[model samples]
Target: MKYQQINKSLFETNRAKFTTKMKPHSLAVFNSNDIYPISADSTMPFEQHRDIFYLSGVDQEESILVLFPDCPKEKHREILFLKETNDHIAVWEGEKLTKEKAFETSGIKTVYWLQDLGKIMFEIMTQCDTVYINTNEHYRANVETETREDRFTKWLKNKYPAHAVAKSNPILQRLRSVKEPIEIDLIQKACDITEKGFRRILEFVKPGVWEYEIEAEFIHEFLRNRSKKFAYTPIVASGNNANVLHYVENNQQCKSGDLILLDVGAEYANYSSDMTRTIPVSGRFSERQKAVYNAVLKVKNEATKMLVPGTDWAQYHVEVGKLMTSELLNLKLLDKADVQNEDKEWPAYKKYFMHGTSHHMGLDTHDYGILTEPMQANMVFTVEPGIYIPDEGFGIRLEDDVVIQKSGEPNNLMKDIPIEVDEIESIMNG
Candidate 1:
């Protein structure tokens, strides 16, 4: 792992929280993500499943975590099964976790190799009444690939059909929504890295530079800062491309007087930080561009304050819509009649600002959080609001990662990043 090792106490606390929610005599299992293949002998990079990482801090493939809090044998509880490693294997494929190293990484006392999993699981399955299966139940999930966890779930159900099946998603949804202090610090580290990348680009961007160049600059900064990769596929959209919310082609040449929308972030210790900043290619926004940019910044600032505890996720967006609507009306994108006759389903504000104003941002860019439930303190969220004007050939968005506080306003993680017109202009020209 390029990033520093996280304290095992965070994973210990996470496991405790999850196991406490389990039914008595129930056992839960989590698997690392498989190294996806592209073609024969070709494969994508290995990325550990966030669920398993959250519980055990195991960042390697072919690893499993079994939480059997009520096992008859005391040592059977909180077990980690890792792939067996030897000196020969270490020399060929890099170092895998040794038993003692695994204990240090995960805070679990008992560790076994993967080969013993079947025998050990069978012995424990009979001792437990219920088996908890982890599933991807995030609202934005559209997974089609058969994950390692999914295959294990299928096998477990077929082999032990008599055992009661339970869902771990609900418990995890609530637990992962609220961040641990350590997790928050990791996310803040990711945000700090993103700040460095953004500031780097502020000076690197210039008219006639290709969009891919800007993307390269960000990756360079992220890699040096120990972020293995971006939190998600970055969007280096320039000019009209910004109007398309998910623009990522990054092939077009940036033109003078055009705005580039950088929807990018750096990940540290598997925690994510999401940020979007739209800046002029020539280091100076025209009068009209500044107006739209300031509007989005104002909305972002106001929406962040509303992320306190007890704020309903759905209602908060509705309120943010009203805020954007007023700004749209002032920007002359909409008039009184446009809003008055606008359908509640698709308001006039949708013409300019189409996407949601905020989303829970942490482990994943769109992290695991039940949006229907009320917000809570220590929950991290991204406050991003944008106004896209295709006809005007420019769009503006300003975003910041913030932690919802128990009292007062949320704390901005990217507060050090330049956002104001004067600040950005000064840095870009400096």
Candidate 2:
């Protein structure tokens, strides 16, 4: 891990929050992500499952966390299972976490090796009547590949057929949505690293620069500041590429008059910071580019104001669509006829601005938050509004990470990062 150790108190608080809602005499288990394969004898980088990482601050592979609120044995209530390491294994794959170190990292003294998982779980299963299983129940989830957690869930159910099964998604969705103080600090560090990358690109981006060069600048900055990598696949779309929405083929040369849409973020301590900024390739925006830029910025600003307590996610996006409609009307992108004749299901704003204005952002880029529930305090979100015009050969979007406050206005984490046309222009020219 490139990042520093997180304070274990945060995990302690998270466990307390989760256990408070668990049903009596129930045990919940979280599994680490499988180190996915590339081809023969090679695998992608290991990313700890966010749920496990949230409950226990262990950032390692082949780890497991068990939470049993009604355990007869006090020491077994919170336990960690790590991959045991020996001299030969240590030389090949590096040193794994020892029991004492796992205790310090997770604040859970009951630690065992992965090889003992079956016996330990078997003993604990006899004491509990109900088992809680984690699932991908987020609103945006569309998983195709079976994950490590999925396989464990299947085995646990079949092996313990007599036990009553429950879903952990509901409890976790609510708990993980709200950010702790420590969580907010880690997210801030990610945002700070993203800020550095953006500032560097403002100076590096010019006419005829390859789109991949801009991507390289961001990677360089993130590594220097201890970020493992981008929180998600970055979108360094230039010109019409930005209009494709998820376009990631950064192979084009950025032209002088074109606008580049940067939907990139950095991950520090496994927390994500999503940021989007559209800037001119030549350090000066054309008149039409400036018009669209300010319009998206306006929508982004007004949309973030709606992220307060009691606001519904679905209803909030509906309200944001209305805001975008008004801006598009002024931009002449949608005429009175287009507004009147458009289908009710898809508004006239869809012609120019198509995606949702905001999504919950944290551990995962599209992190956990039940969409049906009302918004709550301390929930972090990204307010991103874009106007993509493929015909015009340009696109613009402005995004910022914000913390929804208990009252009044929400706090903008990217407030110091350049967003305004004047602010971005000044930095590019500096």
* Total clashes for model 1: 0
In angstroms, the error of model 1 at 245 is: 0.7
Q: Give a tens-digit lDDT track for model 1, residues 269-292.
A: 899999999999999989999999
- lDDT to native, each model: 0.94, 0.92
What TM-score does each of the candidates earn?
A: 0.99, 0.98
Tell me, by lDDT, which candidate is best.
Answer: 1
**Which residue runs does candidate 1 get wrong by more than 4 Å?**
none
Q: RMSD in angstroms, all models?
A: 0.7, 1.0
Clashes of each: 0, 0
- The candidate that wins on TM-score is 1
